[model samples]
Structure formats: C-alpha cells, structure tokens
Target: MLVVYTTTLFMISLLIIDYSTYVLEYPHSFKYNMVKNK
Candidate 1:
C-alpha cells in the first residue's frame, strides 16, 4: 500500500512538471515567432 501511494505521487509530480513546461514553452515559442516575423 505504501509503495502504491508513493508511485502515484511520483507519477503525479512528473505529470505536473511536463504540463508546466509545455504551458511555459508554448507561449514563449509563440512570442518568439511573432518577434521573428516582425
């Protein structure tokens, strides 16, 4: 039971990191494109 709980917590943290990076990178890329076009 403890092992399962720890695994689930680890998975959740990984997902949060992935999602945060994606969210941050997407807007940064979009802004970069706009600047490049200008």
Candidate 2:
C-alpha cells in the first residue's frame, strides 16, 4: 500500500511538472517566433 501510494504521488508530480513546463514554454516559443520575424 505504501509503495502504491508513493508511485501514484510520483506520477502525479511528474504530470504536473510536464504540464507546467508546457504552459510556461508555449508563450516563450510564441514570443521567440515573433521576435524572429521582427
């Protein structure tokens, strides 16, 4: 039970990290392209 709980938490954290990075990077890439065009 403990192992299962830990694994679930780890998976959740990984997903959250991935989602946050994607959110953070999306605008960054857009701005980068905008700057490149200018």
Off by over 4 Å in 2: none
Weakest ten-residue segment in model 1 by summed lDDT = 23-32
Pick the TM-score winner: 1
The TM-scores of all predictions, comma-separated, are 0.89, 0.82
Q: Model 2: per-residue lDDT, tens digit, 1-38?
A: 99999999999999999999999999999999999999
What are the Cα lDDT values of the candidates? 0.99, 1.00
Clashes of each: 0, 0
Q: Candidate 1 vs. truth: CA RMSD? A: 0.7
Candidate 1 — which residues are off by over 4 angstroms?
none
Clashing residue pairs in candidate 2, if any? none
Worst 10 residues of 2 by lDDT: 23-32
